[model samples]
Target: MNTKLMGSALIISGTALGAGMLAIPMVLAQFGLLYGTLLMVLIWFGTTYSALLLLEATIKSGGGLGLNSIARKTLGKGGQLLTNGLLYALLICLLMAYILGAADLLVQAASALGLELTFMHSQIIFTLTTGVIVACGTGVIDKLNRLLFFVMLASLLMTLAVLLPEFSTDNLSQVSNSDHIGLIKTSAVLFTSFGFMVVIPSLVSYNSEASDKQLRNMVIVGSIIPLVCYLCWLFAVVGNLPAGQLKEFASVSELMAGFEHDAPWVGGFLSVFTGLALLTSFFGVAMSLFHQNSDTFNQNRVVTYVLTFVLPLVGAILAADQFLSVLAYAGIILVFLAVFVPLAMVYKLRLANALPERYTAEGGNVMMVFALLFGGFLLASQVI
Candidate 1:
């Protein structure tokens, strides 16, 4: 693989796997192993397809602009404003979610070492760590992400390997009542889980020199890693937990805590891995948000720095206890902005240009309609 391709893959993979991994097992556990794994795959496809749609839109529009610019071009000024607002809100929510998760991990680590700290103190530490990383600039974040991505993959594999022996086929048979509710309720978690798709356009814009085939390949390869990781994680946790207990623990930390009680090293290792995963995500979002904000305000570094660093930390502190709930709620808005709207743009472009040679939609109107309907249904269900 080309060096740039490798770097892009790491960036994409790291961005996708962040924070979501920590919550996947618990989300999947709600619906049992088999069903949850299947749901995850469905989510992966939906998210990936949406991302491709966005990429197609980006390509047709000349490919340099970020999502906000594309939305403005396709949707007009009002549309642009709405999209920008949604993007900002979504980024803020994501920032808060990551910070909150990091703070929780730090607190857990401190508690494990017999040093009890208040949530605020932990939040401060988490914020500062993230701020320092952000302040170091994109080059530093990119470099760190490259190394951390490998460490993250290794830690994930190692943790999964240790838990594999304990996997139970009987647990896979158990199904969550929520799955019967169809994609609606399931989408709450799925949309949020797959929200990283929003970063795809940004990724494409960054790796502008990459060939079309290379971009597609990178996306496929990048997306698959997370799908496999999510499946393994679901298998490990869902198979290990009893059906009744699974409902009580809506967060992955609880499941990992159970594992930790039985296997301290495994739990500790996973916890650290989980923290790094969130950090990687935080870095990506911070970079993207900073870049977008900077571009919007005509590259005002001060505004970018302050918004990137401060907003998330404040949101995190305010939402320390309700981190997961906030994530679930944010999923509703994100599914529309991240998935639905972009799909529509792609479809519209496909029709306007009769099968254009470069960066065209694959299945024509049929695929476009499907993307629209599916994305719309997800958005509507969440609202109702």
Candidate 2:
């Protein structure tokens, strides 16, 4: 892969492997290994397809523009409003997840070092630290992302290596054939883990010089990393914990506690992995939020600061539990904006006879129709 393409791939993979990864074992453990793994792969395929569609829309647009700009150019005012609104909501929900996730891990880390801190205090501190880093702008975030991504990868490998010895196929057969409600909820939670859309538009601008082929390869490869990672993570986690205990796992920490029971080293390593995952995601999401305010809208820095970081921080603190719930909600909403809207942009472009000669999306209307049905089915599953 080209260095630029590799970097782009890492960004997408990093964002996808956020708190949602940590939260995965909690939600999916109930659906058991078989059903949960299948649902995750399905969602991954859909998310990857949607991300490529978004990429196609971005390429058709000139360059250096975000999703809102592309939607406006392609879909008119209503499209712009819908795309931007959903993007803002999606980003805020994501930031909220990171804030709570970071705070939880920070508190655990501090206690391990014998320096106790409350969740609220750790959250406030994390907010301040993130605010400072995000203020430095996208260039800094991109550079920092590359370095932290390696650490995140290392931490993940360490966790997996430590737990692999404990893995048992005994847990893989636990399946729920009659519990559709539980299965649906599990799918909703897993949906949030595939959070690659928020950064897709940014990737186009980040690698403006790269060809369509390079970008598509990067997106596909990037999405694949998370799928593989999630598969490993779910296999290890579900295999290690009993079905009875997993059904009662109130949070990810509880799930980790179960893992740590057998492997003492897992506790500290998981904290590091989870924290790094949260930060990697935080940087990408914060940059996208900030850039939208500053570069896209020409808003004041302070205004952007509040909207991008502070507001979500407040929201996360006020209703941390609800923030997790909104991850599922936002994942559902993202189907329309991230999946359908991009497909809409393409169809609109085609119908209007406005497709630039340099189009890159494959399958044309056939692919669009297929993706639309896929997204609709995914959305319907969550709703029903």
Candidate 3:
């Protein structure tokens, strides 16, 4: 792969594989391995297609434009407002999830090392540490994220190796909750895991000289990397812990606590893995949010930095235990930016013949409607 393409692809993968992956086993434990794996692949496909749609629109409008600009060009000011509103909500919710998750892991890691810290203290420490890195800008984030991504990959593999010895095929079949509604709710949260679409426009500008095929391949390759890792993670975790047992934990931190008692070694490796996962995710999402806020508000760098991290930091502090809930809500907002906005932009662009010679996303109206209906069902499933 071209170095630029590979870097961009890594960005997508890093963004997609966050603390969100930490919740997969917890959610999948209720549905069993077979059904959960299917759901993972289904959401992966939907999210990848939506990303292509966004890429098509971005390339057509020229690279480097933010979501607000793309929506404005293709769907007007109302569209811009809708995109901006949803993007803000989705990004902040994700940042809050990462902050809360990373803080919990930080506390755990500290306790293991004979040090102690309150959850609130860990939250502030983790946020400020990672926030400074994000504030350094995208160029720095790209390099650091790539290096951290590799460390995260190593820890994940090591964690899986430690846990796989205890894996049982019988546990994979253990479904304590088979209710479709519960599965739907879990699916809504799982959908957010593949939300690399938010960063596509930035990637386009970052690799402006790349060919269209290179960009498309980058999205597919980047996203598929996480799907493979997630499936392996699900198999390792769920195959070892029965759904009935996993269901009892109130939060992912509690689940991590369970790991510490059952296997201190696995907990050590997992703490490293989960922490880096959240850290890299913070870099990816925070970079985008930082840029998006700056572009939308036309603020100075200090103001944009404050706009990007302050709200999410406050949210993480106040609702430190709402990690899973924040993810579910982010998933709900993701349906709009990841599905509806991309399809809408592409449809309008085609209607205006604005992208006549540009590379179009393969699917036509049928695919668009399928995406809409599918996304709508996921949204409705949340409330009903």
Candidate 4:
């Protein structure tokens, strides 16, 4: 594989594998492993297709613009304004979720080592420690993100090794009759779990010389890796605990506590994996948010960094207990950016005959209609 392609794919995997991975089990517990897995596969396909749609629009506009610019070019000022607003809202929700998660992990780590720390202290420590790398700009984030991605994978494998032995077929056999309602409730967060499309424009800008094929490969490979990982995670969790026990976990800390109680040895590996997942995901979202601010403001770098991190940091602090809620809301905003915005741009391009000749997203007008209906279903699911 090209090194650039590998690095870029890691970015998408890293971003997609974050807080939503932590939150999925919470929503899926009542939904059962069989139904949850099917719903996830559906979402994976929907999100991956939407990402390719974004790629087509980006390529058509000459391949170096942000979503805001792409929206303006393809859909006019009204489109730009809507895209800009949704982009900021989505990024902030993601950052806030990550901050709260990392802080909880920090507190857990401190507790294991026989130290006590307040959530506020942990939030400050996590935000500043990771926030510095984000502030240093894309090169630093890219390098650190790649390194952490590998380390996170190592921890995931180790954690899985411990959990898979305890897996039972009986645990996986349970079914919920309300599977359809469960799918409706969980669709938003599940879709958000695959919400790496926000970084597609950044990937295009970072690899300016990358051919259209390479960009599409980045989205596909990057996203598919996380799909596999998430399934593995869901299997391990469901196979061990059964639906009733899984339903008791309201937060990541509680989930870790359940593992610790059942198999004491798994806690260490799971903690390491969870912490790395939060960090890698944080870098991807924060970097893209930083770039969006920099481009929009064209201000001093310090000012852009502040604009990117400050609001989310404060939101995280105030709502430290609301980790799952924040992720659920981010899923709502993600529907706008990931599905509707890209669908609109590509639809407009096709009507104008402005789509690039060499590399268009597959599936044609039929796919566009599917995307429209899918986006509406997710939005209505979350809202209703």
Candidate 5:
């Protein structure tokens, strides 16, 4: 049972660590280790707390309904619309980022294999292939996601191990010209790194028979693994690469190009690993989107799959080639759906006596205020 739960944990961790892993070191390099570590720790605790609140709510709802449906019952029509709309937007934006990341990594991998495909071709191929796997149904998605996630996670560890002997102490300690503004800016980017909460409903439904302890354990292990992975990734990448070289790339391709120029072997591993990372995330979000739509529309499986898969591909095509900016937007929406909604759901649950006396995530009214403030700070960052 623990082993089975661990796989679910790994799925959430893998989803959280993707796309953002490639950028975290550079983002943190500016803030330096002291501040960067502090911020991630706070964010992890807060997010973990909120995720448990979500778990409690999921458990209380008795597993028959999806998130939006539960919200409709607990939070009325406005809450339902807010969650349904923003959550869908968040997943679509995340899907777009993954598609873009995959295409870039695919081009690099193809060149190494001498396939020589164009960017457009790679993106289309990746989208269509992943789409088919997703359309197979949620069960297929669960199996494939586990396989891809562990592959990606293992490669990341291996890449870091290979690169370890070259790490410079000063590379991590070296101070850059960072200010409050830089930290805030990087925080906005890093905020969405812990976005596995959106998929918690899918996992709960998949393992509908799990106990409260089992559910809590997976959420903790699942979220903490990514938190540790991101920190270690920052340590390895920052300690190995100079600040100037690390920050030079505004894009993943350029960053990967720097890696190849500096260390060709490591770069080769990174390109492949990043590709798998993107695919794992793509599978995770796409699975959640498929299930969410399937439950909402009460439609045929084939139709829901097509609708879920097609929208993101179209969005990716229409979206700008940029990656980080989309994530920043996604983060704002994610915090609301993932972090903020739980506050309301739990508060409502407490008042209505929906929660059992044994529930662990019995959140306070004050926590809701803090969540609201934190979410507002994030929203204000986007506009200002």
Candidate 6:
């Protein structure tokens, strides 16, 4: 009911749904339904805990410092440099990944409507769309993002409803191809799925007036929505496709291509859904980058808009054909900053003081450290 609560919900949901939703079925099909579903729960909670730990650290450092500031305070100059470099890289790569995805989706949507366009044309259109939105400013971006979020949610639910009746329980039992190694690698998808946790500190600092209890409840409830959506989505997608088909497609677009051949209208609708989802996601990350860099760049709105949009557009153009690969790269970088960095910040904060007596996790710093290490291990395993 609180406006801040609503904002937090949007932030969490917006972050959670991003391009990750589109990849769930493909990822799960490799690992099967049960193992994949269980892994999703584990990763979701781990990401949620990591987010809370980051928030606790943010609160301790007077609540206004972004990831860079916290890193500097807790981890010193080296930490600050590492954090800034990683965050900048992650944000840029993430922006490029989503932009390329959006371009691809636009190309798909146009083809569905009998409008043929080349990938380069689609890239130009997407770049322009993003640039216009960024130029309009953050308030406009936020409002559009919320509306697009609902569109994505409705589309996901609608597709699930149609696919539910066709779900096969037997299909859910298909085993992962890579066995243990494959499962761990697939978990990379789940881990980076929650990479938006970086935005929590910004959300908390912006809504500084929110009570500790309210913030905690907001994070829990906000996170649950996406986790549930992912589970439902996984069930529908993995249930609908055969194990053999899933392995052939490295990304969701490839999977949806099959759906397009069988169910043209549903696939067309999904193309639109995928496009909007990626657009809103790009908007969120771009806005965050804009805000993060605004203070450093003379507070000039035009300059901020240009740097945020143009630089990423160039990166996206360079990565036009490698959308999924770019996403994989971004995921690895995000794992380091989103998981390990936050965990370290929480530990440092705890040792410095007593967490302000109102913002301590259960079991104090011990549990927090273990959680971080566990998440770190999961993330590291993916790279090795």
Task: Name the candidate that leads on lDDT.
Answer: 4
What would the TM-scores of all predictions be? Answer: 0.92, 0.94, 0.96, 0.96, 0.94, 0.91
Worst 10 residues of 3 by lDDT: 61-70
Using alpha carbons, what is the TM-score of model 1?
Answer: 0.92
Q: Which residue pairs show backbone clashes in model 4?
A: none
User: Candidate 1 lDDT, tens digit per residue, 1-384?
Assistant: 686677766776777776677666555576666566666777788777777777777777665435677876677788778878888888888888887777778878898799989878988887776776766665577688889988888888888777777767787777656554653465666667666665666677767888777887777777787778777776777776666566666554676777866556688669867888888878777777776776577655666677677777777777766766777777777877877778767766766873377676467778777777777767765666
lDDT tens digits, residues 1-384, model 3? 687778778889999889668888878778777788887888888888889989999998765536877777788899989999999999999999999988888887888789989998988888877877877776787888888889989999998888877778887788888886778778678899987888888788878888888889999999999999999988887777778878777565787777766567887678778878888778888888987876688888778778888899899999867888889999999998889988888888888888578778777888888888878877886888
Evaluated at residue 81, the lDDT of candidate 4 is 89
Weakest lDDT window of 10 consecutive positions for candidate 2: 176-185
Superposition error at 42 for model 2 (Å): 1.3
Model 5 TM-score, all chains together: 0.94
Number of backbone collisions per candidate, in order? 0, 0, 0, 0, 0, 0
Number of clashing pairs, model 4?
A: 0
**Candidate 3: where is the Cα deviation over 4 Å?**
none
Q: Write the per-residue lDDT of candidate 5 for residues 48-163, one digit (tens) a residue.
A: 77888888877776653357776777788999898889878999999988888888888877887889898777878998888888778656766776787778778888888778
Instruction: List residue ranges in candidate 4 displaced over 4 A.
Output: 176-179
Off by over 4 Å in 6: 114-116, 135-138, 176-178
Model 3 error, position 86 (Å): 0.8
lDDT of 5: 0.78
Prediction 4 TM-score vs. true: 0.96
